[model samples]
Every structure is written in C-alpha cells, then in structure tokens.
Target: MNCEEATKLLDGYLDGELDPITSQQIEQHLRDCRT
Candidate 1:
C-alpha cells in the first residue's frame, strides 16, 4: 500500500466504503508511511 494506491483509496476510506482488509491496509500504510 504505497502512497499512490492509498491516495486513490482516500475518498473511499473517508466515506467508509472500503472493505475491512483494504481499510486495514490503508491504516497500516498510514502508520508506516513517513510522508
């Protein structure tokens, strides 16, 4: 889950439209990401 991928999913994440697995991935990415 890189920044670009995460960026594309941002809207879905905010809207709570993503699945559990995907949301977890995004959350983990955010935690590990340094930007």
Candidate 2:
C-alpha cells in the first residue's frame, strides 16, 4: 500500500481491525519504504 492508504489504515491496524493480508501489506510497506 502507498503512504496515503497506509496512513488511513493505521488506526485500524493499531486496533487490530485489519485482516491478515492487509496487515502484511502495511508491514511490508513500512519495512521497504523510505521517506
């Protein structure tokens, strides 16, 4: 996911509301992304 999408999902992710696939995507993005 891009920064915008990831930003929007942050709350859900922190609250454990996102599905595994989405969580994985976010995690991957965070790992590979550089500002």
TM-score: which candidate is best? 1
Quote each prediction's TM-score.
0.94, 0.92
What is residue 4's positional error in candidate 2, in angstroms?
Answer: 0.5
Indicate the residue-level lDDT of 8 in model 1.
Answer: 100
For each candidate in turn, give its C-alpha RMSD to the true structure in angstroms.
0.4, 0.5
Per-residue C-alpha lDDT of model 1 across residues 2-34, encoded as one tens digit per residue: 999999999999999999999999999999999
Winning model by lDDT: 1
Q: What TM-score, to 2 decimals, does candidate 1 have?
A: 0.94
lDDT of 1 at 29: 98
Q: Give the Å shift of residue 7 in candidate 1.
A: 0.2
Candidates' C-alpha lDDT? 0.98, 0.95
